[model samples]
Target: MASRRHGDYWQHVLDLVFLIGVTFKAIDGLGEILIGIPLLFITPAGVTNAVHHLTARELAEDPHDLIANLLVHGVNHLAGSDLRLLGIYFLVHGIVKAAIVIAIIIGAIRVYPWAIGALTALTIFQIVELALHPTISVALLTVLDIIIIALTWREWREHRSLRDTARETWRWLRPAPARS
Candidate 1:
């Protein structure tokens, strides 16, 4: 049916986003781990000094001052331990998200609940981060997560319905056994 095809089309699109998300998360995790670790060597004062220099240099060129200021502010606030902890969080979260996405892609119905739980947790975390840090990107990511949750729920229901229908049909189609 056309509706089934429509669902299939959306499913494929979501799967593609998952594939892309896996890559994005992997890159973001690496960025956090690699960049944040090195940044730990510097004290907050040192970060402040760097931000001052960064602002000076960025101002000399034609670039977005808002970006420079945001980066400076972020670096100014975080301590060494905070950076390391965030780095570790990103790496672990990335790995888990990728694994779940892959499982879902392979039609692992069992992972749907887990994926939903993990995504819900992540969305909550993002909301908290938005409260604390208040970035546009964080807000956008939250919105995207909400959309993904809806799509995932729809897909899960469709898959379950199809599975139940198949089982019922199989039972009905099977030949009746002879009575003893």
Candidate 2:
């Protein structure tokens, strides 16, 4: 009994955490859509000096911080369009994730199967993106998506079971038809 209650509690907690995560992505998407892509993008040539300077500072602060140093160098090496492309991805990804989050929150039973499909699509995209870029953050996000997929499947199963039980109970409680 205690384990059951604990499981229920953890399930709720996971749900809340997933919602918060997706909400942040939604906001991040909005940010990229509205401002990051439009205003902050710079050509590699335009930011060359700044990138070198920043990278140098990062290395000076902590010589062991290779990832930070590497990212600065990497962005400067990338084409200007890469930033814009990433921004576009974030914008679209954000919108889709938010819509799915809303559907899940509303307990739309039909949405579960569709949500799994949608998530699978997103995961594939993320994997492609990861292959292209290979950043730690991108890798972490892909892992998070996998976790959400599992949680969503669990929720979907529970929803179906609950509906089935309700139907059975209703049938048992309903009055029998009178003789013709």
Candidate 3:
């Protein structure tokens, strides 16, 4: 009985952790969409003004400002005709990320195995990207991903143990048929 209680406690903790992770991803996805929309529609002058104020550098000199340069160039070369198309592109990217977040949340709530697989794939992708980038920030993010993966695996194992215990208890409690 004590073991059963322990199992239940661990399962609850796992559920909480999964919930928190999904919530965080959803919030991050929403933020991406929100930020992307405004950036996509920024006029050439607006882009230059924004970048000048933010970084105070020529966009060509900074690879980090590539997105800003693209926006400014697109607006200048294509006029306002391209703005709507760019906006649509950003909106689609945002929607896809947001949809992934929603799927993760739903999968976690349902305790579906696919959720774990999805998270594992995401972690692997991040690690590979970090390796290729080889930057201090990316390295730190990779470390963070490792910790998250460990916690997620632990939670999954605890949930499995709790399910096994419950199944065993149910089997034991089943009444035997009367002998003829």
Candidate 4:
């Protein structure tokens, strides 16, 4: 009984962690969609102008504001084609991620393998991007993906175990046949 209680406690903790991770990923997907919509509609010059306008007050207040300057510099360099491509990329990425999350939340066991596969592929792409860019944010995102992948694998295993146990119990409870 003590062992069972302990196991339940850890299971609850793991479930909570999984929930939090999923929530964050959902929010991230939404953010990507929001950004993508604007990129799709706006021209590169318009984006640069908007970023400058948004950052103007901050830059005035602090001439050395790193984020404002970075945003300005990044938008200034993007071409219209680049913005369009990026917009499409984010839109598709966000939609797929949102769909996967919904499937997993709805308790579709079959989706688990596909979800893991998709995430693994994305992680691999991110890793390649990180190699090229070497950004801190990208590195952190890669680490987060690895952690979520592990947690997801754990949940998958737990669900399979429960399913197997139920099958065994049903077999044991079934009536045996009698010979004539």
Candidate topping TM-score:
4
lDDT of each: 0.64, 0.64, 0.55, 0.76
Candidate 3, residues 1-180: lDDT per residue as tens digits?
Answer: 223353465555544554455455566558757866886767757755665555545554775676665555544554454655656654664565467556444434344344456556656766786778656655774564455456545645555432343354444446667899
- Of models 3 and 4, which has the larger lDDT? 4
Residue 125 Cα positional deviation in candidate 4, in Å, after optimal superposition: 0.8
RMSD of 1: 10.9
Give model 2's clash tally. Answer: 0
C-alpha positional error of residue 96 in candidate 2 after TM-score superposition, expressed in Å: 1.3
Residue range 33-92, candidate 4, lDDT tens digits? 888888787898898889999999999999999999999989989999998898998887
Pairs clashing within candidate 2: none
Q: Model 1, 165: alpha-carbon shift in Å?
A: 18
Ranking by TM-score: 4, 1, 2, 3
Model 4 pairs in collision: none
The per-residue C-alpha lDDT of model 2 at residue 99 equals 72
Model 1 lDDT per residue over 60-163, tens place: 68466888877776776777677667656665566566666666656677777787788888889889999998978889878877776665666566664323
> Model 3, stretches more than 4 Å misplaced?
1-20, 37-48, 55-97, 100-112, 153-180
Arrange candidates by lDDT, highest first: which order? Answer: 4, 2, 1, 3
TM-score per model over all chains: 0.62, 0.60, 0.44, 0.82
What lDDT score goes with residue 3 in model 2? 19
| Superposition error at 109 for model 4 (Å) | 1.7
State residue 5's C-alpha deviation in candidate 2, in Å.
6.6
Which candidate, 1 or 3, would have the higher TM-score against the true structure?
Answer: 1
User: What is the Å distance of residue 84 in model 2 from its true position?
Assistant: 2.2
